[model samples]
Target: MDFNGKCFWITGAASGMGKSLSLLLASFNTQLILSDRDVKGLSQVADKAIALGARVLTLPLDMSDSGSIRKAVSGVLTNVKRIDGLYQFAGISQRSLIIDTPLENDRKIMEVNFFGVIELAKALLPHMIDQGGGQMAVTSSLVGKFGFPYRSAYSASKHALHGYFESLRTENSLNNIRVSILIPGRIQTNISLFALDKDGKEHGKMDPGQANGITAEKAARQILKGLRKEKKEIHVGGKELLMLYIRRFFPALFYYISSRIKPV
Candidate 1:
């Protein structure tokens, strides 16, 4: 419960759930290293956190670029001696049907949502192991559990996180590194608005489901509590999360309903 002096590094901290979590932790006397490609937005979040009493550092990161990830990791190590946790909240969404999407779009989605995620975790693994132990949590979507319309590539990328991080967790049973995969239904973020289209342009529309979801702050509170308990998979959201159970327990009914839901 008391997080005073603990250090947490979060990506995609410029907006949405990452920014919400950053601000929430600020009141706990925690040290935060926030990263995002939006340098201006990251600065604004950092400034706000400073106002809230957290020791904060801002790093510019581009999830689609390996060089940017490396530079940011180096910066964190240079300034912060320890990371109690590394929360990977950076990802991109897709809004085109598989038939309309190009192969290039799939690659682009993987590069950011999958490669960028594992690269950061791989880079920090040694340090975390050497320092005794640390926790790693990655933000995943509800589609990560099963297929959904207009999210072919996006779902694949999130699905990949489950395989990679689950293996990482089992492999590090002795190393003491804990990995938590966050499966969120919807959290009122701009993910849908910024989703990539078939031609790689932003969809630029607010999804009705996204607009009706819980606030990022509420999602963050659930996440923080789950991470504190070191839960293996933290599910966040409202009744929308029932999909996970339906997919697991009532596969036939799930298919029937999922096929009828309109993708906004």
Candidate 2:
């Protein structure tokens, strides 16, 4: 779809893939409503977008707080007449073993990764329907399709996104609303560095796999291509995509291989 003059709302716009996607979209003349808990980072992104000749609205959004999401949505409606695209990219990852991880950390991951996206989507649905159509692209993971070591809660949250968005796609087909579930393997980003640990503190270190993965810009381009094609689901990554097929068609082998693999 032509993004020229269309308004797109993106969460996690402060950094990583979200920021990369925002810059790419800005080049297409789209108006961006960028939200993130980091006000300074959001300002930086907005400044870059503005410099790129795109209209930008920066809003502080804390995915952990439902009230922050509601306020952000309200602000969006007040300033932007319609949302043409909603990209849910705000999420956290877990790097600790499930047994060692605190229950609170699991809840925290679910809150930011699952419920936060759902709440924001629900809030925007009516507005999207009123506008006669809109597209939503959520950032899931390859782990969403299958279990992985050291990423139990993170994987669970992404798995939930698949179920929820699939239902949403079916229910909103008549409304011209499109939902794209983006399953990214490892993209070069700071997600791993900021991943939550056993006690919910940042991991503070990058995973080797993530460091060796595809660039965020490349991933953003692929995502935009998938969205342009209006695909219901798209997987973008390197060798990790192969694991999906292995998990699906060769479950026992996948299990054996996965068991030997160290995520961190």
Candidate 3:
């Protein structure tokens, strides 16, 4: 897609890969509508993008609330003319034994990671279809491709996104709407620290593995390249891409190895 002069709406734009993606798009002279629950951080992103010569709009959004997403998208369309792409990146992760995980925590994770994506897509898809063409990129994870211990809720939510978006892509292909799912392994981000525990509260600590992973900026660049080519799916970070293929081809062996590995 020609990003120049196009407008992209991105959720979770306050920080991490979302922020990096926004910055990368700004470099391409794309207009951006950035949203996050953190109004202060959203403003900072908009300010930086604006200074870099990109037309930026910031909205404080609560992804878990479908109503908020509808209102925000309505407000954006009420002002900005059109959105060329929709990047669904707002999500929450969790690290806890499923048996010990609270039902509320599981609901929260699904709310932000799965339901939020669905609601936003439902709200914005009409605009894209009406315009004749558009792209929808979602940030799933390696966990989305395969299940993992201590991440049951996160895995389920992302997996749901994969299934739903794939169907959506097929259904909308005739309408010129494209969908891209991002499977990212550990990328140096605070996802682990912010991941929820059984009580649905932030874990408040970083996972060493993720801390040593690839930079968010690098991941963003790779993701955009894949999106520009309209790839069905793109995997970022290290050997996780290969692992995903292995799992698809050698499920028994992959499952055995995955079961033995521990994430810190």
Tell me which residue pairs clash in candidate 1: none
The sequence of per-residue lDDT tens digits that candidate 1 reaches over residues 44-83 is 9999999999999999999999999999999999999999
The CA lDDT of each predicted structure is 0.92, 0.92, 0.89
How many residue pairs clash per model? 0, 0, 0
Residue 227 lDDT in model 3?
A: 89
Worst 10 residues of 1 by lDDT: 1-10
Question: Which lDDT value does model 1 have at 113?
Answer: 98
Ranking by TM-score: 1, 2, 3
If both were scored by TM-score, which would come out higher, candidate 1 or candidate 3?
1
Q: How accurate is candidate 1 locally (lDDT)?
A: 0.92
From the highest lDDT down, the ranking of the candidates is: 1, 2, 3
For residues 1-264, could you state the per-residue lDDT of candidate 3 as single tens digits?
Answer: 889999999998998999989988997788899999989988998998888889888888998987788889888989887889999788889989988898888999999999888988988888889889799999899989888989999999999998999999999999999899998998988788889987778899888878888999999999989989989998899865778878989898898899798854
Q: C-alpha displacement of 61 in model 1, angstroms?
A: 0.2
Tens-digit per-residue lDDT, 1-264, candidate 2: 678889999999998889989999998888999998889999999999999989999999999999998999889989989999999898999999978998999999999999999999999999999999999999999989988888999999999999999999999999999999999998999999889998789999988879999998999999889988989888887887999899889999999998898756
